[model samples]
Target chain A: MTWSLPLRKFLLYAFIIIFGFVMLYPIIWLLASSLKPESLIFSEPGLWPSEFTLENYVKGWNAVGDVTFGLFFKNSFVISIIAVLGNLLTCSMAAFAFSRLDFPLKKVFFSCMLLTIMLPTHVTLVPQYAIFHNLGWINTILPLTVPKLLATDAFFIFLMVQFFRGIPKELDESAIIDGCGPFQIYSRIILPLAEPALLTTAIFTFIWTWDDFFSQLLYLNTVENFTVPLGLRLFLDSQGESLWGAVFAMSVLSLLPIMILFFLFQRQIVEGIATTGVKG
Target chain B: MRHIRKNTITAYLFLLPWLIGFFGLVLGPMVSSLYLSFTEYDLLTAPEWVGLQNFIEMFQDSNFWQSVRVTLGFVLIGVPGQLFFALFIALLLNKGLKGIGLYRTVYYIPSLLGGSVAIALLWKNIFGFEGIVNDFLAILGIEGRSWVSHPDYALYTLIILAVWQFGASMVIFLAGLKQIPGELYDASAVDGAGKFSQFKSITIPMLTPVILFNLVIELIKALQVFTPAYIVSEGTGGPSGSTLFYTLLLYQKGFSYFEMGYASAMAWILVLVLATLTALIFFSSKYWVHYENGGS
Candidate 1:
């Protein structure tokens, strides 16, 4: 049945708004529940907290003995930052090679890189673990961050390759004519021009690294070495219903950095996924 | 000749980091993992040759079979459920709606946070017996059990969680929808085609490529899902093993049980199955997936 345009628009808006609210309700609920007292969180599931308190945040911050949420946050930031820098540098270099450089066996190497994009990480998990274990790097951030330095994240390389290909070859040709070497041309021309792709790589690397749980769970054994994911998992193992408020508080805290990044770079994140089809 | 040599050297220099990573992290480990699959290595001693033993035992393992069932159920159900919502919302938002960017941003937020431990933990509480879900059900005079804790319903909650983060796929689908020339719709309308007929004739055919891409990517991802099941079941694989994902069981075997060889076998099985499934999908796409430029 055909309806009037204004009536149709109103109904559409109403439906969209209701569905969007349902999509976002869990996150909003978590925020509200974190503010409520421990006893009231499950009982009072309304959006509004009956008794608002920062006690959960306070307690969750100091939940672990001598190893507070501050340390976990610091640890997460350090790993994510290092990973972002590593990916930006290494992946961009590889992308430049694939997109702009003329090299022997380039087709074969490029095809191999593309194949790795679809290869499940589980296939290499055991042997990689053994290699790291043999290196005495079991409890260190080296396992998590070192591979990133070597451009192991093929998706970022593919992304930057696509970005780099868009740049005109004439710019690099002229740079070569001006006596600039390949390295200089890459730094002076390509790196500056490919800022958007690099930033996308950096943002995604940070978020993915921050959110990575399995590798962190496998590598970091001690509480002192734990990142945010491991630290949050500690809450689950150590507490029952009594500390649900604190767990929720820490959960909210863990998502804060990512949420901030999402708000700041929502357009780039969305466009990145659209262009590359990278899945987390 | 000298210039060609110089270019080769320069290119090799640029690819050095990736080359190191390729060998050390990916290819080398892949070869070693394949070898480890047939050996009885447990980190304390050198690998002893035990050809086909791990694979043999895997077939008889009931837990392995359970995990396979759970994981297949998740991928079969979750991926389509997610893509359906993604495509539906994308179609709605592609109608030249005002404030479209705001809606896209609001919808995309969940996907950005979907993979995190925090969301998994939140999911556990939300599906708990005394959780917000039950509270909502009570308001409607419906009694709700602990969904995440129930064997029959545990995996469905995780599937719902997967479907909840359809924002990324939605964004991708929206981009695809925008690329469909509006003239097609206009032409179809001139032929007296209804909206549903227009969508079926033009929209579905044009969107098949994107649908295939999303299906394959989401399928591969859904197969490896671990965090939600791990967090929801507290790493135990559930009250009755209903949430026992393939990767979770593999993790238990390798790390917890120290059966690295067995885990490697499981990994190879996953890789083979994944490769075959991907090949099948691409092969099947010949008759279905459409491209504007036709076959390249």
Candidate 2:
């Protein structure tokens, strides 16, 4: 609002740029190291590679099995997509029920659902893994994606509930007046209107599932079935001749989708995460 | 009551997925865990009725207390570091300066990828011997050990990793900042209040509810931290067992050592501890958390 404000503003931008570099340096360093030769991963440390190579990418991607890098990439992509779709669909539907619909015993049921969200997943991992073991779903991708379809994550449901609450009551009344049933209203009206919220949920689901290492560790036993994180861990664990460059390479590669997602959905991701924080 | 019938069916259908998951995946195992906690159950042998033996045995186990100490050390040390860093960066980002988006994006990127095994691996290199940190330290003629492998500082690397993910909480705080009426600061400024005074009097109280929310989630998340502790400790909670956070300890007990019953008891104790702490937070909310809509 004044002349001094411009000077302060300039200083602020300068400060932020420095801070941004500080934050991003590790990632940049990883990417750069991934390009360097294995012998030089920790041996040399500067801004760029003395000898740049894509061999680490090749090695890291194919690290899973005799399988091509494309197969594991496809596996990661497929699981994440299905999981995200399942989360967005089932959670939104549940949120609609809890927030907008007039239902019997709603308050009691809704509170119980919230209680589940409050409990940490690690607390139940042992028993749940035992249950899954008995049910014979241990080694398959089914355990990972199926519960997502079942809306196991209560946070997404709660997020969708908050978003649903934000929509004016008039839209629902108007849809009802037009003779749209609950499912129709959900499919045609609410789903279409709640696109941003759905994207938020889907993106969050995709990232969480993609980055989840512990579950992948517990569920996928075979190296061929390993998710990106599991495969990367294996790379880390191999003996003295372990390829640090390849591990770093695969790590950077795995972050590609998330980086792209953040860049594209930049505004909504921040806004959605923040909104839920405020509401909670 | 008549209209409620139609909506009830619809609600049940909508909630069918969650209900099934809750009952089958969560609640069923939850009750079973409690039952198992009271028994000496290994996967091979059926659960022998052990009464309170698991609980009594735990009282004698020093490792159990060691875990409590390590986990509490993590929560106590890491939570404040994470929250304070988040809040500070959040305040800086809330300045409405140009290119704040750029700052927000870069800062939040680490959190997006923080939990991945790759980051854990990267953390080893970044914080370990011959890592960037030691390299920097060496330039100043100071020697640093393999921080990730050594017991004295193994947990600090995990703490750094946890703090790196403060981007999530920071972004939340930025949102909280926006909700505070900018006019509050304007009035404070007009009243000749300095920034610290304004922050103390206006920003903190206004932001209390969000802080409380962040604190509760952070507390729970910190209590359950597993990945870094596992990876950095080389899957052993190693270099004298310095980094064995509670969840990792439970995982090792259950899967590694085949002590399912003991791990179940540990898991149930974790649940009770967290539940009690969260309830304590809820009870204390009336004192500090000032909801904008009003109400004690």
Candidate 3:
């Protein structure tokens, strides 16, 4: 009993369009605000610009305490790039050990890794803050970048592990028979095949690091060291000082990088999400 | 013995970096927190052991209960709302229509950027008194106030924000739907199963595990709902403390009020609550979460 295609087709398209609009509304508002003149932001906030201007973008780009957004973007880009690379190298290697390599206490260790996700980061925040403070690393970029270098992004590691588990075990066996060592197989086979997961991890790490406000707010105390979120939030005071237009303008500019990145590699990320679930 | 040693060495080598980090960053601090919760430390001075005084004081604190209520409100409202929105869209996207990936990508942009200060600021404007939301309501002639500042509506706005990021869950559900085997749908159709019935039995049961996974992660994330609330509340949890989530409250006490010990205790209670919730979920899974690889 085959049903008519148009009915299903209409429903699908209808849902997609509606959901798409819901998702794009805030983004559209931000983009529009970014191009609006300062006065019009308050006088008239519309979906389309009444009179388009590049003032907001220009001010936003240059108004980072005379530091310019170029520096902020550079800071964020360096942090995210280093973090993504660290996550890729260390996380995949650790994932390989848990997924394929047979070793003593592997079960116990893998379970411990899983348990990390269950533990809330807030619970550890106090003491970790203390340690960083004691080490005089509280105000440095070391606290943010160093942890990723050491594979503390357990979510990404677990994701890579799940992806690794999906690979045919026979490949490892065949590679072994062919005299390819464990590192060789992991590097040559597992890492390459896990590109989707790797890409997803990279995209997520970039997004998270780019968006991470708390850490930036904590470590980078000075305005010169401010990331985008911290810089944006530094303005909009909820009490008396409410710069809604400026806030929106900055908000829109801040979202552009991640939005563009998503548009570019979202296929791989979505596929990565699906594969992680199924592999688990 | 030789091969096992070699494998063990390899495993340890692979794990060396993470283990060092886990110990120095996660494990050490985790244990230290257990001690910190019992101390009266304020960063400038060494912690003096106060025994269970912190725990005892927590029970009598009104802010503690308020935060608990706020956190629970967030978890309850946010998780289910997110799941429903995600599944609804997943079902729509699962129809294999044209430009499905495009819609998925667009919907997911918020999820990726949602946690950042940018979205939080956007949320502030969207939910503020003269923001886009109120502007739309004004169009409909329904008077709207500053929802983000209002205790009655602040949490709900955050929940809406949470639900809006259902892209990840939707993607997971999409995957689960794809693996449901077309033969089952075919068989169900032959047996006179309608769309709803087929979805009720075949789809629901098969996708229970994915739902459970999403649920647990969402619960964990919801408890850590600090960013939006922090930004929205102007970092003070204003307007009668409406946006004072548990983590936000912890931050206020530890960082703002300089009550590190008290905050540590609050943090532990948070961990306890989440751990309990996760355990309850796992225990209840036997009733609702069906697994193909497991025995009934």
Question: Can you tell me the DockQ of model 1?
Answer: 0.81
How accurate locally, in lDDT, is each candidate?
0.92, 0.83, 0.82
Off by over 4 Å in 2: A1-14, A278-280, B1-7, B292-295
For all predicted structures, in order, the TM-scores are 0.98, 0.94, 0.92
| Quality class of the docking in candidate 1, CAPRI style | high
Name the better of 1 and 2 by TM-score: 1
Best candidate (score: lDDT): 1
Report the lDDT of model 1 for residue B138.
90
lDDT of 3 at B24: 88
Residue A197 Cα positional deviation in candidate 2, in Å, after optimal superposition: 1.7
lDDT at position A20, candidate 1: 91
What is the C-alpha lDDT profile of model 1 across A1-280, one tens digit per residue? 8899999888888888889999999999889989998888866656899889999999999999888999999989999999999999999999999998889899999999999999999999998998999999999999999999999999999999999999999998999899998899899999999998998898889999999999999999998899999999987777544788998999999999998988888778888888888653
- Clashes by residue pair, model 3: none
Classified by CAPRI criteria, candidate 2 counts as: medium
Summarize candidate 3's per-residue lDDT along A112-225 as a digit string, tens digits: 888896788777888888888988997677888888988998988899898899999999899999999888998999999999888888888888888877778767887677
Candidate 1 vs candidate 3, TM-score winner: 1
